[model samples]
Structures are given as structure tokens and as C-alpha cells.
Target: MPARTYPALSYELYPPRGDDAEESLWATIRRLEDTRPDFVSVTYGAAGSNRETALTLLRRLLTETALKPLAHLTCVGSSRAELTDVVERLIGGGVRGILALRGDAPDGVDPSEGDLQHAEDLVRLIRHIEAPRTAQLAAGRVSVGVAAYATRHPDSPSEEHDIDVLLAKQQAGADFAITQVFFQPADYARLLTRARRAGVTIPIIPGVMPLTSTRRVEKLGSLAGIEVDASLLARLEGARSDAERRRTGVAATVELARAALDHGAPGLHLYTFNEHAAALDVLDALGLERPPEAGTVASL
Candidate 1:
């Protein structure tokens, strides 16, 4: 049999807050770009708080490098007209891909009346914007991606129900799916199988967030609904020092990536958490090297 195809490795980034933030982000970006990711995505703040800054960073990436940039767009507080405008703006700025989401509602606002309640709605809107009728003003067929949760969504009553919702989003026009970060490779494998069974045929990239700090890992686990394996948690708890914890975390992540690759995962989606050292260390442990030049995909 031919070599199994793995999904391309990529990463998610958030826009910076100020000069210091910008400097830090740029440094991280440079390190990640050296790895030659398949693509790098820039996230938008909740309720579109960082819309302009996100766009500016996206444009900079487009102009300054050859890397394919994916922009995250959420329909949390904006109207259909506003979303359409934002889509148009991104296309006008030469962005060809988007990660669509139903972001958290603005502070103090009830989510029920939010402008966009679901990701499928945003996917549909993007499809409409890319239609031939609007093709004259827009780039042709922008690639739309949607998020998936390996573990049940925090608000979801059941994992099956979440998979069904993901399938519906794919049918509605999402080109691909990127899952929430999970520590165990098995969780991702099972989740992918369940999603396929639920009729979600798009590529489901497993998201991996390395635990660089125990406190941060615990916080992220709570937020993402990832069940930290008791054994690993115990190992972390037994660590004698902060450095030991970080080292153990890197080793754990490396093992997870190896298992994922062996089990036929399409690709790894790393959550850098705006820090590069831990991710870089994990990549090194996995024997993955940076792409030779800018915008090139890293090879196994």
C-alpha cells in the first residue's frame, strides 16, 4: 500500500496587543515559520474586539512572507451585513482561507440574540459570498474551515450530538475541520472515527497543545474539556521543580504526536499558546525539521 496521507501540520496564532506583544508574537512567528508549517492562522478576539489588528497582522503576513495565512472570523456580535463586509475586506486584502466560528457573545450580552448563533451560518454566508454572482468582487472559492471538539463540547450534553452538529456544518460548506486540543492521541483517533461515521468527510486535523506549565495546562484542560490522563497528571504532580514539569510535559507531547502519526492521523494542529519554545522542543523530539525556506511545508 502507498504511504498514508497525513493532514498538513499547522498552527494557530493570536494578534498582538501592543509593541511588546507584537515583538513577542513576531519572534514566535519566525520560529514557527522556520518549521515551515502548511499554514498559519491568526485568531480574532471574541466579539471581534481585535478585528482591525487581526486584519493588519494578516495583511502583513500576506505581504511579508510566502506562507499561506488563514484568518479566523467569528459571527458573535456582528450582523449578516457586517460579516459580509468583513469577508469582502479579507478577500480584497488577498486572504483566501478562513476559519469560521460562532464566537462567545460580547460581555453582558445574552448569546441567544447574537448576530450569528452558529458556525454553519457563517459557513453559509461565506458560500454565498463566493458564489458566481459575487465572484466579480470576490476571490474565487475561498476555502472555509470549521472547528471540531474531540471531547464533548463544554456546553454539549453528548459527544454524539456535537459530532452531528459538526457534520451539519461540513454539509453547510466547511472545507475542513480543526479539532480542539487534546492530550491523548487515542482521544483524537476515536473522535475522528466517530466524526467520519457521523458523515463528516472533511479533513479533521487533530489539535495538540503542549503542556509547558502545569498551572496553564490545568487551566486549558478545564476550558477545552480535555480529560488529563490520571497517569500524566500524577507525573506532573510528582515533578520536583518547574523545569522538571516543563521537561515532562514536552516528553508527554512528543509521545502523543508519535502515537497520532502511527495511528494515521491526517496531520497535527499545534496550539502554540503564543509561546514557541515548548512547541519547538516537541517538534525536535518528533524529528520534524523546519522547512528550508519560507512558506514551505515541513517534511516528516
Candidate 2:
């Protein structure tokens, strides 16, 4: 289970929307628990919508399961006081990692009006809040994670600018980074090249797109501001039945994952939109169905 030998694994999940969704999500959580991923990230809503439900889910993950939760905290439409409170709550609840983000603009709101304008600022703020509590923390500091873009972010001026932004986050105390969903291994290779050239030394985990179906890839890929991989989509479209489609999608993703590992990716971060089947399928195909025995892939 050495880091060089076996990459770390993680998942992205969102808060369950309703009672039925919660039950189904819990089932998925249980199944995922069996694999013992290094950590599971629970996404926050844009501008803190559904904040309570997200916190409740994180709380349950802390109490009822052995899984470590990485709480996503967005700075859009929130004040410093609010974010400080949220950080405090996360620490008090035994959470160690946070994915700090400058969330996308909500309806009728200007993105620039937020108290924290950049993810770097939020990273500094989290470190500032956690400084005094170092004595109580058994794992050293709160492991702050920030988003990295393999493709140019919609708000970015250039890919070089994205690399600069990532460097700034690292300077601001970010422990590591997880990339936004990318379609091809080349995209990741290019980003890593830019980052290393710019002196960004933190580990960057690839966010594996859940190519469970053609429709899911198109819709979520668009929403994430990444175009769907035409090659992967065409394969999904060529499948004659639902089962065949699932197999096709999983196979394409496995190839992408394998390519990423070959390129020296630290680990894979599979986006599970509250379903475990496809994510598990991709992991099993990668021969990572069981968690590593003695080492943590994500050591942050």
C-alpha cells in the first residue's frame, strides 16, 4: 500500500434531496463504506443552499460510519463570520479536511459581492481559524483542499492563470487539490505539466467523471463546464441495450482511469451523484475493490 505503488481513492457525494433519496443514498453509503476510501467529500450547494441537510449528512457520517468526511465549504453569498462559524462546526464535529471553493454565482446575485472573492482567501481563513486549535488537533492542521481545473475554468482568463491560482492556494495553506472533471488523460497531463512548471508541489488528485450513461455524461459534464468526451459518448450511444450501455460506459472510464494512473496521478476521485454502483464498478475494474490495508492514499 505504498503511495508509489497504489494510488489513493476518494468519492464526491451530495446531500440527499428528500426522504426517499436519503434512504437510497444511505444504502449507497453503506455499500461504499465497505471499500474504506481515504475520505468521502460531501458537496455543498451553491451559495450555501441546503446547508442544513449537508451538515446533517456530514454529522451522520461522523457518528454512524467510520468514513472520514471532507466538508465542502463555499464562500459565495456568505460573510467571513458565517464561514468562520461553518469551519468551527466542521472542526468541532471531528472533521479534518475541507474543500474550499468560490462557488458559482446564484440567480440574481453578483459573484464579486461575496466577502471572500477567491478560493485562496478561503484557504487562508480556514488556516487562521484553525491555528489556535492546533493543540486539540491530533492530525496536525485542518487539511484544506482546493479545486484544480484540468480544462480552463469558465471564469479563468487562460490555463496559465488557473495554474497561478492553484499556486496561490497552495501558498495560502492548501494541503492538496482535486481536479474538476476532465474527459481525457491528455488534459490531466497538460495541467500537471503546467502546475509543476510553475512550482506547485502539492498532490493533485484526478476527479474521475462518472460516465455511467450517455445522458449523465452530457448533462453533468455541461453543468461542470467540461464538454462531454465525444468518443466516450459515441461508445455509449452505440450500445444496444441498457446493460450493454452500462458496460460500455464503465469500460471507457476504466481506460481513462488507467491512463491517468500511468501518467503518475496521485489517485482517483470518482464523482458519485449519490449512487455507488458505477463508481464501484470503475474501482473494481481498476482492481481497487478493497481498501488498502496499511497505508492512506490521501495522507492529508
Candidate 3:
């Protein structure tokens, strides 16, 4: 295969909750547009709390931006019928790709509340979904992706079980997998090794998040069942100011990105947290935001 001319870059965004926040989000989107990510995704809330918001963002992205939007559909609190309706809405809105997920249950609720039990089930549904009469299905069908956990998912029985779930997703029709954010690239490597051994051949992209807020990132990581490197945390905590800490975080992200690509990972799926400055800075530092050559797949 020929070497890639430019690295593949993608971003994740969450819907804004209020007027001020919405304004901020647009500004971020505008800035990110300049960087020209391969695609951008909007996250669905846990238990489907923000499904409409996510849909609206996707629609606006299709019309208002140059970015390709990936809609996230989760089996959080939706029945099979309801899930189908959501997919129809996306197709109607011209979304060409979806990230199928088994999202987190709302606080104090049971995960079993949803009709679709697993990511694999959602993936299968998306693969064979019949488009509603009102909508235009992009490219005849939507491209589907599923999440991968470098470490064990919080609800998974073990690491092996989580890997099995990912393999099942591929069998169910996922075109690729984007891993949860992890501190160590080695964890992603281990996950990929196990996946390949299990006969999974689809692209698996490493999710990268630049740590700007030490406390907030740690808390979020813990909630997602991600392991933190103690020494790394200690180093961040040692920074005398927020600026210094962010600089350290950016440096670390660049290092991690290099490791993932060097290890044969397909690309970087950055968790932008609805912000773009830090992620853009990291990409610029890594010299990965340039345009790809013609005929290149732009995945590296």
C-alpha cells in the first residue's frame, strides 16, 4: 500500500445546553472547520436524553458547515421501533454515517430499560434498516461504527468479554471501531492484538483527548472506567498553572498520537469535548491537519 499523504483526523462534539453554550459551540465549530477534519460527530446523551439535540446538530452541520457529520445512535432507552424512527430521521437529514453505541443508562436506572440490549444489536439494526419513504438514504446505506474499550467496560465481565463484544459488533456489520479514551497507547495496542487474534480485521481508531483540566479529565475518565497513570497524574498536578498543565497535556497527546499510528492503528478519533483549540493545536504540532493527496483514503 502507498503511504498516506495526510493523517486522518476526526472530532467528537456534544450538544450545547443553553444559548451561551450554543454560541460557544458554534465558535468552536467554526474554528474546527478551518482544520478540516475528515468528519465530525455529535454525541447522543445517556438514555437518549439529548437525541433531538444531537439530531439538530447533525442537521445544522449538514447545512451550515463543510464537515461531514456522523450521528451517534444509542440503545439507551429506545425500543426497536423508536430506534428505527431515529435512524429514519438521520437518513432524512442526509447523514451518511452513524456510530452505534450501547449508551450508559441514566443515573439510578437499570441498563435493561432499553429494548436493544447491546451495541451489536444496534449495529445489526443499522445494517439492515429500511429507509422511511420520506428520506433519502445516503449512498444507499449508512456506514456504521461501534465503540471499543481498550480497558474493560464498566459493565463488562472482563477484558476478554469486552473484546468479544467488539468482535461480535464487526460480525454484525460495523465498518470500524473507535476506542474509548485511554491514557496509554499500549492499552490500545493490547486491545488490537486481542481483536486480531479473534479474527477482527476492521479498522480500529484510537480515541485521543488532550487533558486540559486535570480534575475534570480524571473524573470523566473514572466514570468511563478508564485507568489513569498515577505518575502522569502526579506530573500534571505538579504544574504551577493551568497554562503549564495544558502545555504538558498537549505534548503528551502528540506522543500518544505518534505511538498509535506507529503501531498500525488506522487513525485518530479525537474527543474534542465540544471544544477545538486544544485538539487543533495538537494536530498542528503533529503536522497532521494538512490536506490529503488525491486517491488517498486519508486514514493513517
Candidate 4:
């Protein structure tokens, strides 16, 4: 049989908190492996709060699984030298891809304290780093990915400014971008229209985070800097119980994913929040249950 593949689908996971959580995370990883995502990304918590744990998980994924793991690097609370060390460590650890981020300021930490100011700056840094391991260089040196904002970035004054930021990162050698979770397909289209007008040609995958719970949608929206569609929000809010809310979330996410794919989104980058069932259900419903044919989608 042909190697299993996915229709350009990817999943995001976060580092676990303890040994038990690590075992659970491995189980989740194994479960998702059957989906054969193009790649899976692991997030470093805000301000590099989970750096060690994230790196540990990345190394484990590299050694223990066939999954391609992309390590997230942030410029929130580290100096340039500190970040350089982290980059070197990743290369030494056999990881080949990175997601450069200007992570949110950790609680009670001023954002200005970091030496690397913007994610674009970190993108530049990653592009220039020399890998210590020849094997890592052969693995493709360092494929740098950056974040894109489908809705305007939280700190950006306008959507145009947000596109410009992404354009700058592309110029700095970002391989591709993954957007923050967004519900409206039009939001992604508008962002892409502006980006293309500005000459950004890199793939921008739409991020999909299922609502999961009506009560948490508002907080999720706020954190992602996205606006929940009023009608969808109403449907979710009107759910009478936890199970009903979850069903509404899954159904709504499936609809949103269909709309996004219909609008020519390159692919979907799911924010799994370390949970796979809802996201897997949404993908299965969309007729993407089988692996994608070879050469149909770009490799990570």
C-alpha cells in the first residue's frame, strides 16, 4: 500500500507538563500519526516559558516517530544570544523546521525587554544561523515558518499593516506562514488579497481551532485576535449543555473548514490544543479521511 498521507493537513501540539502528561501526549501523537499529517508543530509557551519541555518533545518526536515536527521559537523574553543558543540546540537535536514567533508577553513581563523585537527579526536570524550538524543541514538546514494574521494582528493598527508585516517576514526568508485561528473565510481572503497585492507569494495556511465549548469561544477569539461571526456565536451560545455546545462547535468548524477550502485556501493548519478527536472528526467529515496522493501537496 502507498504511504498514508493527508490532504495538506497539519496539527499543532503543545508540550506536556509532567511524565504522565508526556505519556498521554505520546499516545495522542501515535493516534494522529494514522492521519499522516504533512507535518506537526509543537509550540513553545509564551515568552519561552516552556522552552525546555518543548525542545524535549521535539527531540523525542524526531527520534521516536515518523512525524515531521516543527519547533516554535519566540522572541518574547530572550536576548539575541539566548535565541542563538536555542537555534543551535535545535539544529544539534536533529530538528529541521522552525516557526518564528513574537510570542505574547508573559504575565507581568514587559514585551520590550526582549532583544529580538519582532518575529521578522527572528526570521532573519534563523535564516542566517549555521547548523552545527551536517545531517541537520542535509535535512534542509532550517526551514523557517512564520505566523500570519488572518484577522489583523492584535497590536497592528490596520489589516494592511498586518499584511505588510507578513510581507516583510517573507522578504526576510520565511518559507511559509500559518495564520492564527479564524472563523470567517472572508477574513482570510481579504488578508491574502492584500498580501498578494504586496507581492507575498509564500503559502499561508488557514488555522482552524474548533470552538469546543461555547463558554471558551470568546476567550479563544480574544487570544487569537479573531472576531467570531455573530450568527455562529449565537448558535453556540444558545446551546443548552456541554454536549450540545461541543456538537455545535464541531459542526460549525466543519462548515468553516469547507468554506475555507472552497475559497482556495492552500490548506488547513489545525490548532489541536493537544486534543485530536474534534479536529479529526471535522477532517473526516470533509472527505479528507484518506491520505493525499504523493506530490499533490508540498512536504514540510
| Candidates' RMSD to native | 3.1, 3.1, 3.1, 3.9
**The candidate that achieves the highest TM-score relative to the unseen native structure:** 2
lDDT of 1 by residue, 56-166 (tens): 999999998767899999997778888999998998788889999998777886777666789999999888877864556454588899999878898899999899989
Reference-based TM-score of each model: 0.90, 0.94, 0.91, 0.89
Higher-scoring candidate on TM-score, 1 or 4: 1
> Model 2 over residues 61-91: C-alpha lDDT tens digits?
9999999999999998888998899999999
* Candidate 4: residue 45 lDDT (0-100): 85
In TM-score terms, candidate 4 sits at: 0.89
* Top lDDT hit: 2
lDDT of 1: 0.84
Q: Which of candidates 3 and 4 is the stronger one according to TM-score?
A: 3
Tens digits of per-residue lDDT for model 4, 119-166: 999998887785344454764557789998878778889988888899
Candidate 3 wrongly placed segments (more than 4 Å): 1-5, 130-139, 292-300
Candidate 4 stretches greater than 4 Å from native: 1-6, 131-136, 240-243, 289-300
Q: Model 3, 1-300: lDDT tens per residue?
A: 876455677999999999998999999999988877888989998877988888889889999988999888889767899998898778767888899998877888777877898989998887667434324543366778899988888888998898889889999989888988888868788988999998889999999898766886798788888778777788799999978888888888888888888888877888888788899888877787467544767665
Model 4, total clashes: 2
Give the per-residue Cα lDDT of candidate 4 at 153: 76
